[model samples]
Target: MKMGWRELIRMKQRFTLMAIVTTLIVLLILMISGLADGLAYDNGAVVRNLPVEHVALSQDAEGQLTRSFLEQTDQPAGTEALGVQSMVLEKQNGTKDDVTVFASPVDTVYGPKELATLKPGQVLVDTQYAKQSGTAVGDTITDFRTKATFEIVGTVSDGRYSHAPVLWTTLETWKAWQDKMKTNYVSAFISQDPIKTDLATYTQQQIVEQVPGYAAEQNSFQMMRIALVLIGSLILTAFFYILTMQKMKQLGILKAIGIRTRTIGQGLVLQVFLLTTVSFAISLLLIWTIGQLLPGDLPFRFEWTTSFGYGGLIVLTAMLGGLIPLRALKKLEPADAMGGMTG
Candidate 1:
């Protein structure tokens, strides 16, 4: 470890360049990770925040809540059918914004904290909508389609669907707004326990995929993230290999002077470990600072678990990169290596 530090200090310019490059790559990776998570949260926060473990959709709906038509008779015991529809909410100033309206039974317990029974003409809206539209509790919001107005009684976090903020209403009010009777139908059923009914059941992940454009967007972002990881690994490997080649003569001289090959290998691994650790720390700090400065509406989210997970991956890949050049060191003869002979 001392030798590794000495070597890095001796070749400060070269090692500094490598560290900067590694930091940039890691920063890009963290940013992309945040973006991916942000998009996922924006599109599926409502369903993800549900207390239910499984959602039962009509078999014929093909796993889509919007397409499902479930009635009270179809739901099992302890399950409440919910109605979901996308609509525009008009502000007093006539500014209309898209929102997903969710109508659940008054006693349903499948929403975020602070969620409770909704009375007629009263609604709970996502905090995002409140921030965007500058509406608060006691403010009235009108539906563009039915021209019905509801008082905003409270706010819920993580309440969004397909990138739209969600508004919670009573099942009776929702049916009335849609010009349907109470017995008409609901989109799906939410339950914490598993249901063995013939209807189609979907886990939270599956439900997220059912959101419009959610699957495709997430797939694209994930593929890009994977590509970035592969590219970063390759670059690190190549850099370390080149650095190793430059130090081969020194390594051979040390070996000739009784330094064990294992010791040399450990030194190289230590250098990579140090470089990756420092670079990852700096990158995370930069990300945190930038995240703090970013506006709330940018749809960017950062999680400590994700940062640690990616940092671990970077360290592992960088260490693996260092190990790739060890084969060359093992094959080198002290005489030939010192003499600068390739063979």
Candidate 2:
């Protein structure tokens, strides 16, 4: 390990080049992972943040809440009926923003610290929507089509659906807003327990996957992340393998002089660990800085646990790549190495 440290220090340019590559790849992976999480949240935050585990949808709805049109009779036994409506919220200035209204028992929808059980005409808006529309507590926002108004009681963090902001209100208010088809607006039935109804049931994750464009978006990001990790691993392996070939005679001389192959292998892996550690540190700083500079409306999020988890995976793969050259090291003929050195 000491020898490897000295070698790395001596060959600054070579190690620095490798570190740069690792850093770039780590940055790409982190960015893609963040985007995946952000888009997933944007597409399904309403379902993801609900304090329920199971959702019972109408048989013909195919697990999609938006397509589910239910009567009170369709609600599963012992579950709360939750309705979702996508519409536009119009500001006094005629500016309009897309909003998905969630109508359920006030206690069922998660809200910010300021929120309590909302009154009949009061509603909780998504923080993103509050920011976008400049709507705050006590402000009344009008529904575009119906011109029905709701007073903002508070804001809910990460409350969105299908890329639109979400507003939470009592089922009574939502029911009053529907002048036609008053009996068929229930979108889904939610419960923490497994639903016992005849309707098709889905878990929270399954419901999120059913959101339009959500599954496909996540799959694409996942594939890109996997590809980047693989490419980083392969590059590490190829670089270290070439490095080992260049140092073959030197390694053989050390082996002949009593150096254990295990110790040599450990040294190489230690180098990989050190390299990845530095690269991860740099990548993390870059990611955080970029995240800070990004527009607030852009769906980007960075979490310590997720970033560190990816870093750990990169380090593990890099160490494994470092070990690939050990086979050649173990099979080297000391005499042949020396003869080639002499030649």
Candidate 3:
């Protein structure tokens, strides 16, 4: 390790260039990872935050809450009915915005205390939607289709569904609106107990993934991340291989002087570790700073767990890349080492 540090300091310019390349690659990976999480949250925050382990949807709905419809009798006795309606909200300025109305008993939603006390004609909205529409407590917004007005009672954080803001109200309020629309079915059944009905049942995570565009978007991001990692590994391999080629003559001289092949390999591994660690730290700092400057409404979430998780992968890849150069080192004979001196 000591010799590796000395050699790195001696070739600081070359190593710095390599570190910069790795850092940029890691930055891209972290940015994409954060965007993936943010998009997933935006697409299905409501289902992800439901306070239930299992959800039962009508067999025809195929795990989708919005499309599922179950008559009160169809809901299993042990489960509670949850109503989900995709509707447009007409702001006070007469502009319309997309919203999903969730009608469930307050205890079923993992939301603010204000949600539990909601009465008929009053609703809680997603905080993001409230900010975008300038809707606040005591403001009245109308349902564009039904023309029914609801007073905004409060705002709940992370309340979204199918990329639309969610508005929370009681089942009774939903039933009143349904009477006007002549519809008579809840969206799904939700419970901590396993749902044993003939309907399609899914875990909360499965339900979240079924949200429109959720699974496709996440799969796309995952593919991009995999491509980036592969590209990065190749780049590291090429860099180290070229560096090893350049140092072959010097490595021969060290071998001729009785340096053990294992010691030489240790130095190379140590260098890879140091370089990857520095690159990861720099990338992490850059991503954090970028996150701070971005708009709150932008779909980007940077979590420490994700950054560190990717950092570990990067280090592992770097180690693998360094191994290719070690093979060349192991095959270098003392006669070949002295041949470089003679030539």
Report per-prediction Cα RMSD to one decimal.
Answer: 3.0, 3.3, 2.3
> Each candidate's TM vs. the true structure?
0.88, 0.84, 0.91
Assess candidate 1 and give its lDDT. Answer: 0.85
Model 2 lDDT per residue over 1-343, tens place: 8878888999999999999999998999999988788788778977887777988888899888989988876666678888888878886667888888888765554333333477777888888778877888888788887788888878878567889888887777778877633444788888888989878889999999999888889899889988988898898889889998899888889888999988888888888999999999999999999989998788888878888988888889988988889998999978777775443
Please report the candidate that would top TM-score against the real structure. 3
Question: What is the alpha-carbon lDDT of model 2 when measured against the actual structure?
Answer: 0.83
Candidate 1 ranges beyond 4 A from true positions:
112-118, 136-140, 149-153, 180-183, 339-343
lDDT of each: 0.85, 0.83, 0.86
Off by over 4 Å in 3: 106-116, 333-343
- For model 1, residues 1-343, the per-residue Cα lDDT tens digits are 6788899899899889999999999999999999888888888888888877888988888777888887777778777778988887898878889889888877667754344556777888888779887988988888886787888999877568999889987777777777632347789888888876888999877988889989899899989888888899899999999999998888898888898888899889999999989999999999999889989888788888988898889889889988999999998788887885553
Pairs with steric clashes in candidate 2: none
| Reference-based TM-score, model 2 | 0.84
- Clashes, model 1: 0
lDDT assessment of candidate 3: 0.86
